[model samples]
Target: MYIAKINIMTKPEILDPQGKAVELGLKNLGISQAQEVRIGKHISLQIDAQNEQDAKEMVENACKNLLANLIMETYQYTLTKL
Candidate 1:
């Protein structure tokens, strides 16, 4: 089996209100050293595939079809044998 770890984030050109809120919260808490906070989703999946290439394709399809919103979000994944 292989494990896939996917990270989905809003496109750089888009504004992230949640991230902005978190950044504001941090500044309010006196953590001013931090800058440019952006929030994202991390997804993990287990695939019963024969090889890494297959696993990658499956993960990519999932990302394209269901996991990420392609219009505003981008996704990246890493597949590891488990």
Candidate 2:
């Protein structure tokens, strides 16, 4: 069995309002040194697969079809054995 970890985030050129909000909150709390913060989504899945290739294919498909919005976001993944 393996665990697949996926991260989805907007492109750097795009504005991140949520991240900005968090930065502001941090500043208000006296962490004024905080420069910038980017927020993204994290997803994890457990799958039974024969090898890393197959597991990677499944993860890529899931990212393209459902896990991410390709129009506005990019995705990266990592697979680990359980």
> Tens digit of lDDT per residue, candidate 2, span 1-82?
8999999999999999999999999999999898769999999999799998899889999999998999899999999998
Model 1 stretches with alpha carbons more than 4 Å out: none
**Worst lDDT window (10 residues) for model 1?**
51-60
Q: TM-scores of the models, in the given order?
A: 0.96, 0.95
The C-alpha lDDT values of all candidates are 0.94, 0.93
Q: How far in Å is the alpha carbon of 18 misplaced in model 2? A: 0.5
Q: Residue-wise lDDT of candidate 1 within 1-82, one digit each (tens)?
A: 9999999999999999999999999999999888889999999889999989988889989999999999999998888999
RMSD of every candidate to native, in Å, equals 0.7, 0.8
